[model samples]
Target: MSHLLRAEYGPRGRSAGASTWHVVRAADPATALCGRTMDTDAETRAEEEWGTGLRCCQQCGSLYMHEVPHMEGSHPYS
Candidate 1:
């Protein structure tokens, strides 16, 4: 089944490569800011850089995010 995901822009931190993009489950798109449930590790990706925010999956109550474009491939963080 297709799930509704929300993308929020995270600010850069004091450390380098700390900026991230968060993707959370929109349980109540009209009212829910993040999600009502927590995600199991199995449902999350290892490469995701988590910050302060809530995420959930409709099917498993899980959440994950993709690595920043510059952090992936051969481009290194400077």
Candidate 2:
């Protein structure tokens, strides 16, 4: 897990390691912000709001981003 959690850089840019799972659950943005559903859509609008910049789970309706960093380099801000 530690090895897999290395910084990954692609065309878009750098991203979390393997162990650092980025889960996107289907949900409603409005309802999620208020703590309701948890679904994610592949739409441009939703994607913009729930951009890859996210490093944490934002329970907006159902859409969300789960970023689990390594204990050694778990920088939530970066």
The per-model lDDT (C-alpha) reads 0.32, 0.30
What does candidate 1's lDDT look like per residue over 1-78, in tens digits? 123333332344323332322244334333212333332221332223334343433222323333133345665543
* Deviating ranges (above 4 Å) for candidate 1: 12-27, 30-78
TM-score, cand. 2? 0.18
What C-alpha lDDT, on a 0 to 100 scale, does residue 70 get in candidate 1?
34
The per-residue C-alpha lDDT of model 1 at residue 64 equals 34
- Model 2 lDDT, full chain set: 0.30
What does candidate 1 score on TM? 0.21
